[model samples]
Target chain A: MDVRSQVSMVFHLDKCIGCHTCSIACKNIWTDRKGAEYMWWNNVETKPGTGYPTKWEDQNIYQGGWERNGDSVSLKGAGKLRGLKNIFHNPYMPVLDDYYEPWTYKYQDLFTAPEGNDQPTARPVSLVTGETMDVKAGPNWDDDLGGSPDYARQDVNMQKLTPAEQEVMFQLERMTLHYLPRICNHCLNPACVASCPSGALYKRGEDGVVLINQERCRAWRMCVTACPYKKSYYNWHTGKSEKCVLCYPRLESGQAPACFHSCVGRIRYLGVMLYDADKIEAVASVPEDQIVQAQMDIYLDPFDPKVIEEAKKNGIADSTIEAAQKSPVYKFVKLWKLALPLHPEFRTLPNLFYVPALLPSVGTVNNGIYNSNTNGLWGGIDTTRLPMKYLASLFSAGNTETVAEVLKRLMTVRWHRRNVTVGDVDEKTVNAALEDTKMDTATADAIFRLTTLATFDERFVIPPAHREESIEMLENTGDVKGNTGFGFKERPARGL
Target chain B: MFNATLNQFLFVIFPYAALAVFLVGSIYRYKNKGFSVSSISSQFLEGRKLFWGSQPFHWGLLILFFGHLIAFLFPRAVLAWNGEPVRLLILEIASFGFGLSAFIGLGLLILRRVTTPRITVVTSKMDVVVFLILLTQIVSGLCVAYFNRWGSSWFAAFLTPYLRSIFVFDPDITAISGVNSWWLKIHVVSAFSIIAIIPFTRFMHFLVYPVDYLWRSYQQVIWNWDRRTIRNSTKHSEGEKSTNN
Candidate 1:
């Protein structure tokens, strides 16, 4: 089956509270350097608003990810000859202004300026040019301004909606939004890796973490456009391209990634998954409607004896296989089918899955008491405040049925949990919820525990990274014995 | 006498100087500091005008380069193919078309650099020098081609011999000195100058590929597994038995 183990992640959107704690934690660790001030390796995007770098979903501008050139998927932005042709100027690259120009308040001015009359204030200056600038935008500029005409109305996701529906969404009363916390998907069919003209980015064999080799990076900036998520960034000061490393050093040391570790909502789950490596291209190249199914089909059951045998033969460690068995990501994504990969239409076969948040449209208040038309706790999946069509565009490659199914599964879990905590819900609806899942309360309880109250050990089942063998291959075991996994012995600075 | 010295310097010394610098400098930069060796593409800063300028320039340059190579290296073959008047006229027409496109593209690029604020801000001193040299080369080349019709038919007797003499260390200054046109000489000299400064300029992007990317497979799979790991892992119990013992 050409099975290979990849450390994958799941984020329960229902549990996320839209806090940017994970983003700040990741920033402090990875992207606080000179040219990296603009980079947010972990960003929480508010739905119905253009994301970081603004309108990243607008493929018409950025031109990232893969497109079907018949049966095979070709890089949407760059390929062999096209890379050479555009070597002088990448036509599709996002400018610094496309991402807001990184700026720092001249805090020194606040301290150094002699007291004149009023309170001393800092002026915003561009990080790259050091020129005083009028502050306009930032990484979290549209954080919670969901119904704002400036930000939310510009969301590329609005393209999927009819004009009437779009008009309705922009209304203050009908407006709905949720937080989408994102990191590098570390995809199986990584367009960044494929589009790198210099061949700097590669997926690590042991953990499937995508990493860029600093020595090999020539800063072609093709990876910036080729990545559909706009996750890759060019270090203007260093003359190189950089992106999230997935905190591999933390991973090697058996800790969760910085973003995952600092998640305040505790929505993040980390675990290992085994997928058939051979089917990656075929899965990514499938018709738009069939992409989600194709992606799901490639993830082999870790408990399957034959799949486990194939994984072992492919050099997967025994401990990694064990972790795959315990992976909450596996259960949420594969078994319960509550979690879905973000924008499967991008055809990256993204490893990160999201359990869609419930926001039903029909909730109304009568005499200070909230009521739903359905006798059940929540409305039908089709009646969600965030339209099924929008969720379909985001997660299910425009397939509303799959989005509805995922929503039903999530609502079933919520209903099951409510039945346990309070006895307000009727037995008929409880039985229906159970029947919809085609299971008993035990499965729902397991889903509930993992989603809500799972401990660190339960949420994150990190495999032994097995990077030691690679290190040993490059250097003698004795020479590298006590060395930390952090690459670059010296701190990276500007210029050669 | 001026023409003779110029011919010796341009045809003999200049060719060697440019070739040596182009080869050694490119390799040295590739070995020591590979990342700086890039096109330094200013597209991110400004791109709309670049599409019009870069596309035509690159396409015209590639066609013109191959045409020159075929004429210089195998003049006799090129001449034999163009023996008929119709064939010769067609070839000249095509060459003129490419030359005209390249000139227009270069003009647009120069205009872009001067007019576009973003491009001008990023334009280095070397970028200016390279652009001027290219302009001179293309202008001189176009003049020579227009003034001297059917030069490709007689390339074997003129420039090829001169080039061969330089390669053979014979330094036949008289070969090009007898050509009677300084415009052709200017074109050749400026072309050599462009080659000499290429490694130092953004033009090095065309040559510097430290990694052998041409042959590597599209999908990269980093295999960290070595002998010990391979031995420890097996489809069946065979390797497990060895590890257990």
Candidate 2:
């Protein structure tokens, strides 16, 4: 019986207000130690600019994960599969400085009196060793698009094209621009786990949560370099590497991860997933564009009796099966098919899905404001009208249509104050608000079916009294109707 | 009378004492630990790159020390082998070059320990002190080399005979003549201080070597008694369950 429990997450980008509540929550919970001052386990970054810790996505500088090889996939620069047989080492990984140099301001620098001054000035100083320099870069530098305009503008070289070419470039730049909030993807094929020389890192079989055993960590730091997301951090003082654990303690108590729970936008959803263990590699290796759809196809249908039978045979608990049957991710990702995987090109088969974001029209800015009818709130500075180059700098590939589509979807997912008196607006009202003010009935039905059925299916069933009694009796007796624990009664022992 | 007193103490007493302590102490420490021909063959065959580098550096430095001891112990014999001027020139050159090589090798070894992350993490505080002391020894040795160049024959005639006389347990009252040069005094004081510090510092590595060298070759053993106990308990429980059934 191979009862492998899988876990997954979805982040509705539209719900994210970019307030960095999640980042702050994660910092206060985990990274607020002496050596961990610079780590932000959860960070929000604006698109178009090189992210915090600078140029993280540029794999050329910090090689990580695997690259495509024709129709197959192989670890980056590792020549062939046969050559990889004896080689147990993984080379690509982040260094200590790949995150940021941890720094703190000295309070003495603020209170100390200047040589000639009558009173002390309240200026901040580096708290770490009292060295004073303007420390700017750290995690989450892109929060709230602080440096958006620079990323929005197109290059002059792009403008030198003919009218048609310029028009295409403009669209390309505008299309490419969108905000990307990132966190540990908790990849299905986690390179960090595979690369650890000591086997100190493991993905839990119960919930598929990855963890590092600090006791076993010899500080080789291979996990730091293997992670493409550059999420792992090295503690210089402790001489060990640390990373996100996905708040397992909280999850066990039926609460969301700290970052997810504290998210200002209420964009995160936690759920169980059931997948055929055999199909994981096959689905993950599919080409990038088809990956999201391929992953959805691999999900076992909850309604199938065969699946339930097989699951029971495999020793899967009823509660886990119930959770998978009702998972919101299974709905949005597999049923309604509205969500997309972040950076499918990474090839780690990331579980976090995003409902794409859509931006309002360029000319519709009312004093640089855009109103979201779904949330009944105003967003600052409609940058949709910005030039293509500027947009290109924010979003990779300079694809405006994809950016707009993603933003629109994201806006729908944003947390709006639930309307209590409105008599429970049907899926039509929600889909109408989401689908550009003119909702199609079929789309609304699909959304409604997913929202309600997915929720209903996820609720775990409390075992009936009779069933519990029977199970407990069987367990105590070590026999159920003539069946022994191992499915056979002990043979008559040979004469001692 | 000054020359007679100087020759008695410097040539006879101090040389023998320094020689006895350095040689007998090192040899006794090495042999008492059961290090012998068998151990030497094992270590020589199994030593790593760091081991090779450290071994040669210590051996070369020790040989250089003996060269100094011989000049002080038997000034007349040394002068007979080569003229006094020629012997003085060779001693000065050899000591300078030996000190330089030791200093460079120590620097490379220290840097290797520091810059290699894994190695740096394992380094102890005592290791740092030992490196600093060796550095001081090299710098002070260079000072003595410089002072010898001004008048090698004159310096050797005064210093060597006086040092050899120290072996006779006679106080060299006149060896201090013209030794007022602060640089030369500093060199002498620092050399004696370094010798005193060697046993206490990571320079203790020299005392422990060859024997300590074998410890690295042996595989580390870790016992898990707790897990074994748990397995035994589980087996006991399983046996009881079978008996009940």
Candidate 3:
């Protein structure tokens, strides 16, 4: 496998407290300017509620991403493949209002005194009409990911749901709903990077981070509409599109991204994962159900000596190899095999992965509820009387069968034990599963290995060679040039 | 000092000349540039709320402008029909109301331009100019409405007579004699200047109205063969030899 090829991220949702510290830190660093106030490079959202500007997850309104057409992948809603052959641009993206309206206080109203007032009261007003208004919705409106329970309870339509339906929905909601703190996933097939009319946006080969060349951005805002995630924001003042840079400056000096570094929950994990750049299209174009497996197949095993030898041969830096060897991402994502990508159906091959949350629930036996001796259930109480439908809906999209299966799987308390690696499973059991499933040995071995690791490593330490060089370069040469003589040279040079 | 013939040329001929320049220049520019009917159609068809704001702002401003134009054209006819005192009172009230509407509408537009992220991106220097000019006209008109002197007789005896004299091959600078209000002169001059600049700025939307409305109501042409044929005819010459040859 080509070594300087792929990039991936792993996020541990268990540690996330939904404080929005990452969002604010990112905003203060990148998007607090005149045109960028509406852009939140990092935002944590509550699921099952109207997010930010509103229901952004409803892709029916703004069609984006790719869809399957026969054996080939094609842009959804785009009429013909031939017509899209020389695509100057792709359509269907979110506008500024799709996220949130830019709001400002009417400063002039602060000095205006009431009819009988002796002193001017500092009453904040909306600058739009010099009228009194309040900050309503914008970025980070639902950082906590509070489920639709609150909205459903109050909504007339939700209130009308049948008792069974409500029960299933609520259960499903509790099981599925979790705070998803998102930044630019910097996907393998980034819609924003592909749709740029000027080729201004690019994903760095070294780190898999997407960046926009501010100088080249002509402000057509095509990328703004093409991104399914709505990560790209148009800078109105500068007449350019801007997005999360993934804090390359910080990363170059061996530090985490601003959002990841400032995350109060320390939920974010930054590292390098080698993937087959050649297989990106194939993996991304696969059927939705098969996509997760395709992605898993692409994750390189850092411990494999053959993979390491191949990486070194392909001119992969020793530092990068070292960094990848002990990366927290590798441990949590590949070693544990617990982290899952957000909306794998997006077909962007998003690098960011989250560990599927496990919630508490009582096991149903015939008609009676068998309460599990676990604190996983909210308030540590049996909730079977509340209607299984609600719980099913919340957790498993009303698929009680799947909910039961998942619940059974999660109830195996050994899986929840800290610092347990998938590799610790008995070889006999792993071989038995592999044989029973007719699965490939390597795949079975990797999955088993991932489940054995104990504890998530927080340190994203770079190799000493790369770290020292990057620090020295940053200190001496203020700007890091893009090309950096890595590829054009015939052979890998000795370290400076 | 007031030549009847010169006044006829100045008030009557000059005003019409200025109006003709404004009207013809705007129309010519609109025709030459062609209407951005596609853009308007797209906005309206998309069920965009901006169209609602833009449509009302344009229509309100148009009605307001025509009201002033009619008053300028036939002061005596208006007064005779309603009597001088009633006419004067009506003009003042109408001007005040018109100014208020213009002020409010323009304020909304400016607010949208400033606050709406998408609109702010598309806004140009000409858009700012058009907004500010209209705002100034409304402010000046309101000032004139508030500080009227001699009421009905002043307009009938001085302004109306002067306007009529200018039409009859005569000039009468003395008609403006009693009206020493700097505010009135400032208002008149500013209104005229705004008219002159309208053709150049996005204020040309005023001239685009009826034609734009008619054009937009029509459907888009979607025949591929017809479009290709038109493209070939417009882009290529039949007599030209092939470049390879």
Using lDDT as the yardstick, the better of models 1 and 2 is: 1
Query: What is the TM-score of chain A, computed separately for every candidate?
Result: 0.93, 0.70, 0.72
- Give me the runs in candidate 1 sitting further than 4 Å from their true place: A33-35, A80-91, A108-121, A214-221, A236-239, A365-374, A377-382, A473-496, B1-9, B81-90, B114-117, B146-154, B168-171, B208-217, B225-229, B232-245
Flag regions of model 2 displaced more than 4 Å. Answer: A1-3, A70-72, A77-97, A108-119, A122-130, A148-179, A364-496, B1-245
lDDT of each: 0.81, 0.53, 0.55
lDDT of 1 at A490: 42
Model 1: lDDT of residue A435: 95
Which whole-number lDDT from 0 to 100 does residue A290 have in model 2? Answer: 62
Instruction: Give lDDT tens digits, candidate 2, residues A262-352.
Output: 7655566667777666576676677755665576666677667887777666545677778777677776666555666655555666777
Off by over 4 Å in 3: A5-7, A77-91, A104-136, A140-167, A171-177, A362-457, A462-496, B1-245
Q: Cα lDDT for residue A187, model 2?
A: 72
In the range A1-496, model 1's lDDT, one tens digit per residue, is 7878888999988888898999999999989998788888889999978998889998988889999989899988877777656765788899877888778898998889997998899988877667788878888789887436889889888788999888877766667889899889999999998888888888876678888877678777889989999888887656678888889878888889999998888999999989998899899988999998889899999989999888877767788889999998899899988889999988999999998898756566799876767654446666677777888888998899898888877778778888889978777788897897686899889988888789999999998766654454344444333555345344344676
> Which digits, one per residue and each the tens of the lDDT, describe model 1 over residues B213-240?
5555666767544433554645432211
Interface RMSD of 2: 16.1
Tell me how many clashing residue pairs each candidate has.
0, 61, 48
Worst 10 residues of 3 chain A by lDDT: A82-91
Please, what is the TM-score per model? Answer: 0.87, 0.55, 0.55
